[model samples]
Target: MMEAININHFNRHKITEADIIRRILSGEKELYEILVRRNNQKLYRVIRSYLNDEAEIEDIMQNSYIKGFTKLYQFKLEASFSTWLIRIAINEALARLKEKGKLYHISERAEELNKNTILEIPDKKQLNPQDKMIHHEAKQLLEKAIDQLEPKYKIVYMMKEIEGMSLKETALALDLTLSNVKVRLHRSKEMLKDSLFVISHDTHIFEFGFSRCDRITERVMENI
Candidate 1:
């Protein structure tokens, strides 16, 4: 199949992050699109976990990318490019939160959104169209509960649970110790389980669409 050949070709001609970095540093600035497209979804989720407003999230992302590109010369080859970019985005999001006086310390933000509400568990055996609608509603409720968490725990939970990042990667992005990341994630999970009765894995929360990715790429390219 043509798809098979294309896959083989891509594998054979694969580009490493270091190679792309070198080319961009050598003045092929447009190649920055490669980085933006690759990391857009992860970075979007990272910023969204902190701020609820979509416009604010996008503004933070734009600022982060511009900051990253300007500081590209300072990047060390020792760290993965994705990891480095994630750290930059996280810092920008926190800084914006602070500027708006919306920031709270981890301890302060951990004050319970709701301490004693028991949630109803959805039955799993049902596969009818009605069940599907209920499933969708359940997912929305889960997302709402997650959004109520403190930013520290929210970021940790989203990174580990939704974005599939390893504990080490989550710690690196947030500049927390491994133990701290684990503690926050554990507490976050407990909060969700207590509030939702069950976490839904059937739907993605806070997805970044292809149109927005393309728009972000275009905007970053123009600014750089």
Candidate 2:
């Protein structure tokens, strides 16, 4: 398949992620652009993973890249360039999150809208076809579940599930240990699964949750 060939080409590069780090360390600034371009779209998804808005995605991404470039010297080459970049992206998102404090705030508004406009929890009697759709009903529940998450856990959910950030990158981004990232990510995954499962079947939750979108997807799970 064509997909197989493309993946093969990427794998053939074999320079190893560590090689990219060395390139950055050796003053090959231009090469850093290669990494950025390769992952730029993905990095955008990563930023949106936690930040959750299209308007600010670019600002956060650019800021993250600048930070990564400035800190390129500190890169130890112990992990893939992707991992390091992810950490920078996450830290930048976290910083912006603190500044705006709108991530959770917006979610709160969404919850209110869901409660008031989206769902009525129809008492005792189920309605007809259109009413059975209950589309927003499920969404309200899912949003409520997400609303209950701590900021840190919310980041984990976004990075791990939404952006697909790997455990290593999540830990590095938060400057936490691998075990901590794993624990948090695991909890986030379970929490998400449980949250959505309440409104629908497991298969539906899995598909709806993982489907790709115009928003960025970091695939953090790949490296993990």
Best by lDDT: 1
lDDT of each: 0.79, 0.56
Error of 1 at 178 (Å): 0.7
Cα distance off (Å), candidate 1, residue 188: 0.7
TM-score, structure 2 vs. true: 0.55
On TM-score, the leading prediction is 1
lDDT tens string, model 2, 1-224?
12335434545776565666676678655445445545665565466556546657766666666677777778776666667777777777777877876544544332212222333433214567665566556655655565455566666665566556677777776688888877876665555544363453222322222223212223221111
Residues 31-69, model 1: lDDT tens digits: 677778778888898998888799888888888888899
TM-score of every candidate relative to the true structure: 0.83, 0.55
